[model samples]
Target: MKYLLVREDEDGVEQLWGRCAGVDGLFVDPVPLPREVLTLRGCGPDGILGDVLAGPDVSLRSLGDLCVEVWDDEQPVQWWTLVDAVVVAHQPHAADPALYDIVLGAGVRKDESFVELSAPSRFELSGGTTAAAARPSRCSAVDGLFESRDDPAPVPMELIGCEAVEPLLVGTQQPRRWARDWAELLVLDRHGGVMASRVVGLAIDGARPSVLGDGLEDITLTDGGDGRPSPAVRPVWEKWCQGPPSEPNVWAAYDAQGRAEWLELSTRAWRVPAPRPDRSGGEYHVDGRFVTDVPGLHCAIAEALLGPGRYFGREWNAFEDCLAGGFGVIPPFTLIWHDSEVARRALEDGAKDAGERLPYFEGVVRLLERRGVTVLLR
Candidate 1:
């Protein structure tokens, strides 16, 4: 199995980044998104005030990617990526379960998504930097930067096989690198076709090559898995990484975070543009046999809506977004949920809404129904 690192040229042409000689942590479970703290100095009980923190919005109310929204009156001035916060008991001033003196830490500043804006005097902390998202960008980066480095300073990638793509190779760099830090790694077919892409963040460490016959040295193939499905989910990607799968439904082989990782890969692999508004009233089927957890339900739905390696939604908020329009199906569509009992038994009223508990399967049905989707359970 040969692994080639690639990126797009200025004209969107596939440029060879490198022929991978070795990879370190490529096949791993998705890592837990690192958590960051958001501190709101006591503004004397304002609206929606508290140490609201959690990484990646796993709920319906999440603004964008589980980011905590910074408000300017009725409107959301900015949406900052947030995670759960730890208590600071060491600081006597940082008493009160919800209070902290720390202001504008590394997490918020490093975020390029939001620009630093003056928080209308009151919103700014002592450092006078407020993390605010003007309008939550509803976009995902394919290759982190996804753009070519204009005068990139020997981006941290190194690989062999330069003889094949001499034209695409940049000036004078030996053992060329084909991708940026957040570059997407694709599994190519024997005939050099795009099979799977965009699930892995291939970071080049640029180390001295050793016994790596085909090993692309100095590259870490994940977000280090933090708490997400890093190594555990490697099995799901191993075969696909080697070559394109013989068929679909291959993602159903794993469960828990592994299944979720499969869905993530599928969402990228079988991705397609949503049909126009007039293309409504189509009938889709959900393979509910493996509907064991929240991620399982997503796998079933994505396969149902788009095909085998396709996607509709991965979470509640994303599901609702798909229901609105443009995730392969329009409103007034039909959803034939096959093997309904599997999900009904496995799913509990587990999803929380302030206080109300709703079963995920039922929630999906209700949301679909409300969106004019006639869900026919079988």
Candidate 2:
């Protein structure tokens, strides 16, 4: 059976809607509601409904059947859905030694299973070195603003408004290579402020966010050219593309003829260990068994590296064997590259000097595949 594996996170609900909305066939499951949602419900209407509805004069009451009804401004309205499913459970004994006891006991799996899927933090590396240097602290005030809790807090006035603002012309800028016809572009000033611009109708190139369109381009900039735009300017037009983030890495899916039809990227790093030798002179190698499922991506990466030529060498055989043996199911693969000209020269000369050089290249490709990484061998 085919499965659409969803890695759960804080924004998982939104991601579920974005990825599975209107899909032809697929089972959708969420591991569990966040702690905040659970606690909010427990705190009664004031917690779950927010303080806006529970001001000094507001009143609320919990209904008998796993539900809560709230009264705001002398009007009682709104109902909450509640289920008696297990919120948490612990199983001290199990056959699988690696399995943990902590579990969010939701219920029996039907078409979909709601399971929490978590990976190591970006600060935790397989190699034991703290990758935290590159990550922002979770305890920061900015992050705390969105932290989930057992109870919901009161809404601030700044976030509430009942007035509509007038539309304003922003400014113009350069077009991107993937802009399509009638695409909208939003320009941001140095202070992370958005400027308004609309694509009337014209053939443009490049994808969204980086898209360049014809028509009226709204540009926003400070009068002094200090690079920061006034916060007063906001986009009056709608965005054309609604894909995921494009930072850390971008993956484009291709058809049999090498035509790209889909693209995916991570806004953040996947955060795997760097493939390198330890003090013992032995490096952790990834199993290449997963390569078969991603032949197109493998080919794309190989072509990007070896340049239009199919990978031909003993390395290819090793890659195949690794896949056949299901090595990927174990330690997995990791991809790393060296930017030194000396390393490239060595690889070239080694390949020419001995037939064994092909194996080295294959090993690299194999590791990359196992780790779900598409290395852009430059």
Candidate 3:
């Protein structure tokens, strides 16, 4: 029960999955059913016959061996094998050239035919003995128009029997205007399903932008008239630290006076461990943390300051998209402080023997400072 899965690429038949019973195959260009229909008929008892369709479980083995054979006007031109799936599979060269100039296409389901319009175009419909037809409708004003065969033409202004007359006041007057006022902000939950929390404008510094919940009340604004912090702010602070309120030691939220408003009592308070002195010889530790440690917190802060559409998750493709969109930095923040122990460990792990730590720390300090982030060298 061998089956062949053929997909169209820039060249004809970019991918092929062959020889399997009950196996699914993907086809980009519509498959001619003659070969498969004949094959199914030949399989009598135990040959190869069942449902044949592309599915998620379909596998592509020998990915490197697959090559594209392109033809120039019905003549074979060249054959090029992909270097790697990650590289070749997503390359712009894989797109079919013939589809580049396609503007419109139609789809028919049941008795109705739907004509899809792509770009700017005008269309007219005429009926009642094509030769002596009246202007049924003029759809030139529409940007993109489509109508069913049974839809009647819109009533024309002239048919209404109304005559145009100039107004007594010929001069243009200034339009009434209203002052822009602050509106209540909305926040959404992580799954984007429901409103998580809501806060007044004063609490979140006048409706700060946030990702977690819907409505202004859901966010932690700057302290409102009430001294106590907004309820939504506490959860946001905990989420940033990558620890819940129960984990007190790991995180803390302090007021302007440096008083602990909300605190987590976890032993691990966002600190990187010091480097071992014996193995690397005459070494010092740099205590700091990686941006990856509290990605949610970092992302939230960035969103608040820079607004939405700036940050990218750990996904490589998203990172590439950010780069393409002209974003110079990933996190887009200045490092205010770093643990000196973390830098020392990285150096100790990289060096063969003990060495002066000054030069290494200097380089680290320079790099961090250049990015407007403070590096606390302990």
Candidate 4:
């Protein structure tokens, strides 16, 4: 079954965040909702309906019995079929492992926190050691946003939900409300119109306010300027291309629309980690699992370094294809083996063939550095 993810702005204005196609978890393809839709969902002027929404303590068994009744404000009142699930996630700065336990208790296989782009930020392009020392190659098309800079921090947010069957409500801690990194989702009826939407603060208890990175705390960007590529950028890209092949790398060379086309190319070279003998089934690999056997610990490092989205193999021509597609010089993409175990196992298995693995990993670091991806070692 399909699901919609929703969140509110700092002003408490409820808005459409994103929609999950079935239950894949990553919220994508943002859309807008109408204000009138709020009234239909039984929301007051505040865009929330305590009268209609469920509570944080909703149990999984009760979902089948939950139904949302919406009425149009106009005389010929339209009847809308929508159900939401309310999740009042209790998140302290040091996240309780029990939260995951609770969600697992609710029957969700896996969950992750993500920052939906409500307000994208900008950073100045600089070489190094400056306030805005971001990787210059990543965001060439966008002007000032670079590759290596940190992911934008989470802003304050609230939760809003009613009841929907087959609903998976997984929540994560966010930064301050000022950061504007709250979670959001969009709703679409069976007919595919913006039916309804909601948003709310992600309640933070004993947590320190989150800040994504230091350096240029608030250095805004202006249009039109030329900064030479960082002294470290291309040699790294070339060095990896010259080295023995590892994971096939793909660049973020396509626009949001053309993404599928590039993705097809990347997937052709996509590498699935070692297979399980008992359960050999089709599974898209999580990029993080490439490094650590331990889930969550090294996954964050992999994602933080690689950036979000379903990443695949990198092609040198795909980088040019981005430029050809009118995306100015976009960031170069590279893939490397961050798995210490993989290297260690290779060494244990054999010395002669395994020798190149560590050096290959080193080249990956330099390559990722030039392209502006973060490398986190646990």
Clashes of each: 24, 19, 42, 27
lDDT accuracy of residue 76 in candidate 2 = 26
lDDT of 3 by residue, 39-75 (tens): 0011111100010111222122111111222233333
Rank ordering of all candidates by TM-score, starting from the highest: 1, 3, 4, 2
lDDT of 1 by residue, 69-108 (tens): 4444344454433333233221112335433232222223
Highest lDDT: give the candidate number.
Answer: 1
Give the residue spans of candidate 4 off by over 4 A: 1-288, 291-309, 315-358, 371-374
TM-score of each: 0.60, 0.16, 0.18, 0.17
Determine the C-alpha RMSD for candidate 3 after optimal superposition of all C-alphas: 27.0
Measured by TM-score, the strongest candidate is: 1
Output the lDDT of residue 134, model 3. 20
Q: Report RMSD for candidate 1.
A: 9.5
Give Cα-based local distance difference scores for all models: 0.48, 0.23, 0.23, 0.26
Candidate with better lDDT, 1 vs 4:
1
**Measured by C-alpha RMSD in angstroms, how accurate is candidate 4?**
25.6
The 10-residue segment of model 1 with minimum total lDDT is 125-134
